[model samples]
Target: MNKAIVVTGTPATGKTTVAKAIANKLNLKYIDVNSLIRTHNLSEGYDDKMKCDIVDTDKLNRILKQMIKDSDQKLVIDSHLSHHLPKSYVELCIVTKCELKELKQRLEKRGYSKAKVRENLDAEIFDICRNEAKEKGHNVIVINTSEGSKDIDDVLEEFGFLKQFEA
Candidate 1:
């Protein structure tokens, strides 16, 4: 069965909300990768310009691989960087997306600085995370969270989990 799932995208793209929903519905272990990074001291430092942690993807992947190796339950990993884990380690990669206007509102509502907001908007404009996930060879799904057009059940069905959940 598909086991490791990574939820990733530009900030303000509904990654956390969707990831948590999937985990709850599937009875999977929800792993907040940002929390794991802090817990494991995986960040090299903070990026003042970006107003975020400077995570070493190599270190993060190593730790994630270990966690996957040690776990028996399926994992729903949540983070913009979670897609960095090798395709071999992830059964599915879900890239959350938001409309540019909606995303701008979300970032501003979150009290992000103008620069940070612009940076994220640009990332979304260019499909950075999705492209990167694909470049890494992951089995990818694009979820349009802006419209909420993709149902959680439909996503599960697409991932071939509908049969698993049926009694």
Candidate 2:
């Protein structure tokens, strides 16, 4: 777990949950990209229509690259924007997905406005994150996090994270 891993996907698609679980299991540092953006003043402005920050992706990537270079601890970077990072800086890029119905429910539960919900739902429906990650030449893995699929530990095992524990 010494290398950097990024968990990226549409909001409410379980990127945070999966990233945090992987970080905890592997003893990696969990870097929340949203917090990083705020802390580093990386936002260009606020997107009123989207109800979110309009970040400078190049700056974000530069800062993240520097952070990865400077840290001794491994990192699990979590955000829908994280997949924008160049592949050379990451060991793995995980893209989470959820059923559209489940994703809509999750977004509504978060109190997102209808427009925001629709935008994010469209992103998920288009597989935007996964496609972008691959387009960037990342070593990518897609995880279906829809309800009743697989739990975190099972997913980890399936990905060979617990190989040493197997009989």
**Highest-scoring model, TM-score:** 2
* Lowest summed lDDT window (length 10), candidate 1: 158-167
Worst 10 residues of 2 by lDDT: 158-167
lDDT for each residue of candidate 1 in 68-128, tens digit (9 for 90 to 100): 8888888889999999999888988999999999999999999988999999999999999
- Which stretches of candidate 1 lie above 4 Å from their native place? 148-167
Stretches of candidate 2 exceeding 4 Å from the true structure: 161-167
TM-score per candidate, chains pooled: 0.90, 0.92
Q: Write the per-residue lDDT of candidate 2 for residues 1-167, one digit (tens) a residue.
A: 24579999999999999998888777778999999998999989999888899998999999999998998887889999888988888888999999999899999999999999999999998999999999999989888888575578778867885333122
Q: Supply the TM-score for candidate 2.
A: 0.92
Listed per candidate, the RMSD to the true structure in angstroms reads 2.6, 2.9
